[model samples]
Target: MEIGSFDAADASLKFGAAAEEAALNTNVVVVGSLERLRDAKDCHKLQRVLEASPDKMQLITSVARAMSAKKDGASARELYLLPEPVETDERSGSVRRVCLIALPSACSRHNSPARPHALTSCLKGNAGPGSLTVVAMLDDPSLAFATGCAIVRAFPTWVAQSSTAAKMQSKKINVIFDAPDNEAIPEAEIAVLSWAARAIRFTARLVDVPCNILNTTEFVNQARVVHALLQSTLQARGEEANAVSLEVITGEDLAAQGFGGLYGVGKAAAHPPALAILKYYPPGTSAADQATIMVGKGIVYDTGGLSLKGKTGMPGMKKDMGGAGGLLGTFRAAVGAGVPKKPLYCLLCLAENAIGPLATRPDDVHTFYSGLTVEINNTDAEGRLVLSDGLAFAA
Candidate 1:
């Protein structure tokens, strides 16, 4: 209906009388599948139009036509639309620049002339442009990466601060739907990957910053900004939440929890150790799906202790909370991405490793919140101690 000459041989004849009528009046939609690709012999038809068009390539026109004629969803739009070739062999003079788009669900079910293999076969393939987005039945519904994450890479450019992670992002592709609705899940999975890309990038930057710039208070303030987005009830409390909650505990409160590791580590710093907790419960879900308790070890800076590490070990110590960074990442994912209705609890324990007059001495004995006793062993191997308490609490 948008243009004219949409009728391809198969579609032109198969469309119910009504679709047939519409095809007669449309040009952009060539109501057929592979058959329509044959309209232009050699280079004068569709391929020529592709090589010489202004809008470049738009699938909408093609999709509408395919939809009108195919009896089933087989007519679902699948093809390539690339700004440049994805694969090429110069010696064979084979050059292909088009991006690929395929239906993973349907394609994975494809049968050869006589046999059908596993879906893994398709996924393991080169994954040409059209092949990346896919229909996935995620076995786990908790973590984003557990389900799948979208990774993207922008382009080639040299910058003093560029990271390998950033470079990986540039060439990144997305995972298809993994949603509540069976049909929409794959697409939803893809959408969440896109969302995480936007949200996680900022988190990476925040975690990468030096401790001097990003402190416990700063972390709390930023959390306030994020909480304001949905304007859900906020908490910096020490108790369970009514629904959505956030809590920060420190000093005597931590001591009462029997968190000796946290206390001992902080005795050396000007500020006491603080445990930040965030929780979100969805009314829609009766039983939380594999509720995950994510804990981040936010040691702002590490000077090692009685057995201090060299500068080389402490260089990127700013990211010592990388574990916590990942937790915050999961927390934000639960909030930003369309996480399935579930309760998520996050704990970010922050402290600074400083040499103080009251600093913990070598061989100091301490007990974790779980009542696990540990020898001062080594001062810097602190991430594991804090996480033990966090894990015990979460468990």
Candidate 2:
């Protein structure tokens, strides 16, 4: 039970890598309480050991073959999980990089900078207290891929809102049902399945929309449609999406906000710059459980300010608003869900790069809304400039 005695020799391993590497076989088994693995030094040892293996397989099984014949001998299993850890790719044996967790459930990765299952953080247990199994595997790692992503259970078999507080039994499926203790909400599967299709479509469409059609103004406009759809679910999909609250702040309005980063980037364009903001507040729940702010980096056109990008350097700068599209799509989902308790905020900063005398110059000392004066090192770096002011205002 002493953490000091245990070395986290297997701390860096991921499930897939642990399974794939025939030579570097490993699995983590912790004896005794959670307290033992919680120590800082012991955790370090576990990390080093997990990193030692080289496999990319998700559900890895290995046997400690050296033991003699016995019933409980090597068959018994113990499990441990590190909330977060960093290590190189034990699967491909590529350059070591900082991965998210110690044991990943399902990972699809490549040598590229953005790899799969890499960003995923496994949920070691179930939705609530002790009921969630401290098992050997992860539940759909891809479901919670990014930092802000979360898992939620949507529909229930039947509604049970009423309850007589004093007449409760020690154990029973209450008249009002949440998840009964110790049972994994099978709904995460169905709910995520429904969400996945749309998430994939949104991800793919936004990916294809090309930065040209998905600028700050367009992005905000699209979000307005999403808001309208939320207000009334019966609203038809395509054209109805266009009939929402579309408020675009431009010209002097954008300038008055002192968002010089957005203004500077949009100044060269014949079309005035735009700052777009959209909001959605669902009925009921006065305070709301939580409010999330979705902000996208909107670079309408990146001609590279004064430091122009050549043909090859600028092939896909148009898609710079990928983050914005992601945010808008997420809003669409929140709207589609009839339960609108929490208020959601969507902000998109937009601008196009038009080459003219007014265009910002390289090494230009552009002032940001946050009042941080950045030396314009490169015109092509305009994305960060526009994002800076947006981020500052967001703060």
lDDT of each: 0.48, 0.44
Off by over 4 Å in 1: 1-187, 230-242, 284-290
Model 2 per-residue lDDT at 129: 19
Candidate 1: give its CA RMSD in angstroms.
14.9
Q: Against the true structure, what is each candidate's TM-score?
A: 0.53, 0.48
lDDT of 1: 0.48
Query: Model 2 over residues 1-395: C-alpha lDDT tens digits?
Result: 11110011112111222222321212333211112212212232223434533231121222112112221111122323322334753334222211112232223354221122222212222112111111111222332222112211110111122232111111111000011122332444333333332443443344445544555555555555555545565254322432234456786677787888888888877667776766655554232447656677766567776788788977777666667666666666555643335766667777776578998887788778998787777777767777787678767
- Which candidate tops lDDT? 1
TM-score: model 1 vs. ground truth:
0.53
lDDT of 2 at 9: 13
Per-candidate count of clashing residue pairs (backbone under 3 Å): 34, 21
> Candidate 1: deviation at residue 379, Å?
0.5
